[model samples]
Target chain A: MTISTMRLTGVAAACAIFSINAFAEDSSLTNPAISAVLDGYYQSAERPMSERVEGFGLGHTEVAMSANIDDMFYGKLTAVIEMHDGETELGLEEAFIQTLAMPYGLSMRAGRFLSDIGYLNNQHVHTDAFSDRPAAYRAFLGSHYFDDGVRLSYVAPTDLYWTMGVEAFKGDNMRAADEHNERDYKSTGVYTAFTKIGGDAGINGSWQAGLSYLRNENGRMTAEEHDHVAVLDEHDHEHSHSAQYTGENTYVADFVYKWAPNGNYKYQHLTLSGEFFRVTDFKPLEEEHDEHDAHDDEGKDYQDGWYLSSVYQFSPHWSAGLRYGQVDTQMMHDDHFDPQKLKETEVSLAWHQSHFSTVRLQYTNQQGTNFDGIEDDNVITLQYIMTLGAHGAHQF
Target chain B: MRINSKQFLPKALKTLTLAVTLGFISNAQAEFNIFACEPEYAALAKELAPDARIYSATTAMQDPHQVQARPSLIAKMRQADLAICAGADLEIGWLPMLQMKSANAKVRSTDQGLFFAAEQIDTVDQMKSVDRSMGDVHAKGNPHLHFDPKRLLGVAEALTQKLMQLDPDSTAQYQANLARFSQRWNDAIPRWEQKAKPLNGKKIIAYHSSFKYLFNWLGLEQVADLEPKPGIPPSSSHLASLLTRAKQGDILAIIIASYQSERGADWLGERADLPVIVLPMSVGGNEQSVDLFSLYDSAIDLLLAAK
Candidate 1:
């Protein structure tokens, strides 16, 4: 057998063994709930599969197992299988143990988990309203920020919902600096603080707003660097050169307003949400080598982006939404590279077949300034998402 | 001289206000907080602790299977001295998160402050083996046990004991309230039974298994369910078969809760010339379903009206 195929088999076997062990251990007294979600899409873009921003592809199939370990703790593990660079890959998406009974309204969580930065960052892709991530999220947060970390959150004792949280990560996020493979990155990685407040606006309306700040001491390009190189290849040919970055800070503010006409969501309802982000002081580290001459005089990089989306549930089973997103980046001083702006507008129609299944059709128009100058891309995606077993309901 | 009198009047008003505020503060201190996962439990808590602050996470118009986690729910759960829920997985979707977020020691599952009504009674429709094809079936059995009046009384009795355990000072008040509630409930059950005598052995269709306890109590036979499975939407083919069966048999009505979709029931009702009845599955489902007693009254009244 091929080496890749053998590796896939090994990973699959390991996942099976782990899941069986968990079930056997928990099911004796209290059975751990098992759930799986399958997502697929038929997508077409104006450009070729390799050159286009979108293409027909198989999305990830996720398997999740979760249960309470004891009275004071709960454990969850989710694994995903998907194609990565023409090779089948299996990865652990989340594995965490959270405290159920903590003092002073405080809860602690440890393990690899998604960051609670913006409204949609904590939600899975399959549960999102659109087929693709928003342009702001893609450019600012690298689509979604998942990290190995520890978090502590405190819900305040107030009439309105108020929560404050802090997270420390291993600095392995692709958007963060992790240049030295031999270095102990967790000690000097990413740290985040966030606060959220929400309350009912009136009889039928409810709203929530949150602000988050994240600091990455040293940011290094990992796999996403390859995509940047690919974009650069469209203009000038630059041979394999590695760049190190330092002092990256990001700020995000998000808000959501929902009106369900007297708290009844079965019929007509409207949800409007928006998020804005800004990143600053991400500069390439200066090295002693002459090969780094190209970026020696360049100033720090700055980026800002925002997205707004609204969904209207016209009926019990049917809903439609529209989103507008834009990202602007101020690049280093260079002749071939200039400050670029990208914008995307998307419209989607979805049908909730049941609580466990959904079918969606989305159309997106992307207009942006890339390495090759101005470009426009139109994409259409028809997607289906189905869930089996038990999946927890999403937070508002 | 008039200005001096006006200033004196202002001081008098301030003193009165402070006295009233203190009185309210003492009254609130004496009261306990109760957070119920569903409206039926909130209504039951009213009978046992009429003066306790009550909060219901979900209303009758909302689906009990799932709910959005709101800030108010967390705040209520955090302050609750007693947390009562119809917990055969009825509030499984949001309750765990709410409990964790609340971080209130009293309401933890292991604590006596946490009470599950389903644990106090026997449940039906429990699956020996569970699968997705069964469509969101609860492995712990149907959690809609409030429809059975007897089970509700049993749950109330247990809840009263829990309240007494938590607040010994209120023991006498809780017992008195329980006695009054038990008398009224016992008296009302027979009247409801007499009114529902014609519904015995009546064949009916339901949108979901939500009415299982109700059917068991009324001796109504659920001939077929509109949904293909527990949570799955009814397919056209299944609706077609139901239509044929409705025409062939003596079907009373197509019954559905206020929160459920009526498309399948309406389609079957239109073709078969049978009435589609929207019943108040719990309290506050409609105007007439103002409380637990009226919830049953409204449901039975709807059924009898359909006939």
Candidate 2:
């Protein structure tokens, strides 16, 4: 057998062994459901050689264990093994316990988990239709937002589906966490609230819309010292610079629509979804100048982004999708520091071999401004995802 | 402390009025709500509790093995007074998550309000040892027990008892409904058997093991399966082999459920010069299959027509 096939066979055997052991050890008790997903990809990007991430890579091998702790509680743990910077790394993706029966129609979850901030933030990468995350998500939320926190949600007793939820987190996200300044870290750093409503539009269509708000109270970042010299008559003077930031607030709105003829998804279906995000109140940086000369570091920082995508399943095995994403960022007050705006367009075609496996080919074209200047890149990726054991169905 | 008869009388009268208003409001909102995982259980629940609001998570056109977690399903499950399902892990993919997310105490697995129709009947084709190679087989045996009329009657009785337990005031009405339904169903059984006599001993091919109960009930022999194993799609080699078998033996027809893909059955039927029959696997699969009795009637009609 080829090397890749042999490796896949080994991985499959290991997964089977793990599942059997888990089941045998807890045969008397309720055996936890064991599932594993393997994702691998071949990607090539047309960019500067130093800035390109092109090659065959293992995306992430995710293993999940879930079961009912008792009649009143349910628990799930997911761990992922991935390749990072040419080294293999293992990390805990999600570990949470959620209430099965709570008073007053309240359900609560606690522990480390992905934040339900936007439409696709909580979903794993393998579940995504595209090979990579949207540029808007990557720029705005650093791919995804996960933190140690607690969430409480209420499902309204109404004819239509209406739910409201709130969460409190440690605020260890891209723009929130400050690893250098430990003493200034707030205990309840980030708080969020969201409301979602969904209903059947007709016999073949359904839609869901949600509004969310997130606030980070205190965040810190260490800005490196930079020195500038004026070269008018060959005279040079050095000035020290450092900065700190406090926090930020964000708002997001998302909507999703799906249609399946006669309520049968096996033949033909269509899904359309979009999410818009706006970030503001990025507290002004406090600049520290070492020289006696006064330096003004006043700047307005703001970011906004949105993504829209549509996936059409024409047959039981074939599907195609297209996505458009754009992000804008303003970090400095200087007019010469052009505000960065990045736009990306991607298209994908996939073949679902069965319920447990999929092979996809995707192409992305990205063009816009970066910190350095105008930038453009083209990326092509071929990915394969396989699931073994009892993987749960995805939520709409 | 001495004697305030006028004030006491007015206060007592006001309290009585408030209590009566609240009681009326609670009574007005007491209508039972049931959430069924499949159309068959929903049809059965409708028979037992005609006044209760019913919601079925999946239609007959959809696969019962897996389902998307729709928001409406969670909402209905949360408000359900009773949750009924064909639960031999038939809904293992989505039901557990729905139940956990709903956080509704009334219909938890351990509660009296939860009813599993499979638990009321004996299952067949149960494997002694289950492995993935068996192709997604249910560990507790086959869960499609609704095809057999006798087993369905037993499930109805059990479900009626549960309805009585949840709503004690409706005990008399539920019992009466059960009696009437049982009598009507028993009378129809012999008539169906007489009509389906021509189908007896006929060898057929099936897309999946979904028709096991129906075959067992009608004494029809399932000679071969288009799919190599349960839940696995038919491969070219498997279909070719079945076609060769068809030439050697007398195969009556190729049968598939409404929810299954018809490509394999059509492919095999064309080459073997046999008819491909699509049967309503559950209620509401077609316009004619509106309820439990009609679901079977429609299925048998399709099967007999193929013959």
| RMSD of each candidate relative to the true structure | 6.7, 8.6
Clashing pairs in 2: none
Q: Which stretches of candidate 2 lie over 4 Å from their true place?
A: A1-30, A46-53, A175-183, A219-247, A283-301, A331-338, A371-374, B1-28, B235-237
- Sliding window of 10 residues with minimal summed lDDT for model 1 chain B: B63-72
User: iRMS value of model 2?
Assistant: 1.8
lDDT of 2 by residue, A122-180 (tens): 77777888877776666555466667799999887665888888999876443332323
lDDT, model 2: 0.75
On TM-score, the leading prediction is 2
List, for all models, the DockQ compared with the true complex. 0.39, 0.45
Q: i-RMS values of the candidates, in order?
A: 2.2, 1.8
